[model samples]
Target: MNEQISLSAIKNGNINAFEELFRSLYPPLCGYALKILNDSDLAEEIVQEVFYQLWKKKEDLLITSSLNSYLYKAVYNRSLHLVEHKQVENKYANHVLNDNSEIYSIQDAMQAGEIYQIYKKTLSQLPHRCRKIFQMNRDFGLKYNEIAIKLSISVKTVEADMGKALKAFRHSLAEYK
Candidate 1:
């Protein structure tokens, strides 16, 4: 199948070899991704990211078997990771909604206040940057780009801090529930 030729050429830093491989596998990869993810757009994203990673990691990449299995496994694992992360976010969002609903009752309101107070207290214990970023997101309603610009940090950093903030919130608020 000349698989060794392609892999060897790519290992020697042949751009043409990588491009050829990408073009040849693009359709089947997207089709496989679609079968796994059930969404055309997501499938395209997964396939694209898979190829990009292959290119980025070309130097240390060692494929003892067919490259197809390696690529397929990488895409599958990435999709599963994405799904698991979404599930966690959804679970926490549902919990926050439930807490908000319970705040309607008078007795629950006092209990909720205590819960919120405890949450605020714990939040204050976070590093200054983390606290500021969390407040900007929850209290100021700023997007990641805005927060990044305001704090002179990268957008990726802002996104990361928001993730950390959510994790901390979930941990601290667990005491209430």
Candidate 2:
């Protein structure tokens, strides 16, 4: 069940060869995923899914390096994606349920905390003026011109700061996946 032997078989159209590969590598891959996800069942599911996808698309499989590395990377990426999706869904769910509070997030309390921390950290990295404008627009739902008058800066500055803030948020979130 050497990886090279299995990979050769897979590339040559012997799809079942990957069964041994999957059996051998599944645990470590799941372990790597658990480091980020910290959920054993979720980690196992992600690792299983990674293998299922690999087998489903085996015709286009390419192993530039070792198969183990590819499997590990694939599982890691899938786990990260699962976490990120939960965050987005939680954001929508936390919408104002009542006058009490916006109950945002279905993925437990810890994930909500992490998402808030990431948002806070990214906001902190923005230029001070840009951050203020962004908060005014997003938090208070202010119009661009209104924010301009309130901040005593040009409307164009408000627009530009919003743009910068958006770019920073997108860039920071891109790494989360």
Candidate 3:
């Protein structure tokens, strides 16, 4: 297909033209992306996303260069962005793992254990419904509305129980603060 004619037809919302462009370019684009990304699945995904964006923005599409060059550039840019993102994630993970070793001492572990014991004791002293509400919110990560629905109580009741539980814990753990 002539590059200019196909681009024109694509701009005019011709699905056949778009499909033809996609079918012809997809493999080469994926191959180009794979050279940068080093992952077949991610390369395919990048190419697909580029095509999707092209189709989605077809009405405003403008090609100042060859369509092949444009598609290759898009795939290349996206692949590099993904690689940079992964590098950032890996750096963050490494920083956390390396930094935490120095930050936490044996004394910190002992203090944490003592705090946990105090927490458990304080929790046990709470009224049955208040303890349940507090556990639902904290341990189970349930929202107030979810806890209220599960316990067949009003949101106000859940709030009151949580407040009471928090007060008991604060009073019990005051020495640590």
Candidate 4:
């Protein structure tokens, strides 16, 4: 069937047309996502999510380009977003871990304890509101908007406080780096 005809059928709630399109495109889309994400399960999940969204929004769906190009672009963008999110998570984990060596000795334990002490000292030195904002984000895992709402402040204030807290930590811990 022609691409436009298939899309029209899909828009008109034709299940068979949508199934045919999915069957033809699913494998290639999964493969494309896998190449970007390097995880088979996550790639499949991303492709499935794309298709789900496509179907759910069929009534309002608008494709200015070819369907193939549109699907490929969606998969590509989602894969990249997942990769970026994972990188940020890994970066934060590594920063907290400090040393990733497999061997754990008494001296290493002592060093870690000392580092924790320094970190607490630095945290304490922050202005009261800044310290609370930092704790709300890092300790409580609250988002900036949530923190702002809880404190009756603006999101910008939360962001600025977090920036100040991080800057202080970086300055205080420069020697460790």
User: Using Cα atoms with residue i matched to residue i, what is each candidate's TM-score against the true structure?
Assistant: 0.46, 0.46, 0.49, 0.49
lDDT of 2 by residue, 63-95 (tens): 797776677667656755766666322332222
Give the per-residue lDDT digits (tens) of candidate 3, residues 21-66. Answer: 8876676677666655567888899899999999999889788987
lDDT of 1 by residue, 18-72 (tens): 8877776666666654544456788789879998888888889989876756775
List residue ranges in candidate 1 displaced over 4 A.
Answer: 87-177
For candidate 4, lDDT tens digit of each residue in 1-177? 688999999999999999988876777677666655667888899999999999999999999986767777787667667766664233333422343233222333334434555787899899999999999999999999999999999999999999999899998888774
Give the range of the ten consecutive residues with the poorest summed lDDT in model 1.
100-109
lDDT on C-alpha atoms for all candidate structures:
0.70, 0.69, 0.76, 0.77
After TM-score superposition, the amount by which residue 121's alpha carbon in candidate 1 deviates from its true location, in angstroms, is 66
Q: Against the true structure, whose lDDT is highest?
A: 4
Task: List pairs with backbone clashes in candidate 2.
Answer: 94-103, 94-104
Q: State model 2's lDDT.
A: 0.69
Candidate 3 colliding pairs: none
Q: Model 1 TM-score?
A: 0.46
Candidate numbers sorted by TM-score from highest down: 4, 3, 1, 2
Report model 4's TM-score to 2 decimal places: 0.49
Looking at candidate 2, what is the lDDT of residue 68?
Answer: 64
Model 2 vs truth, CA RMSD:
15.8
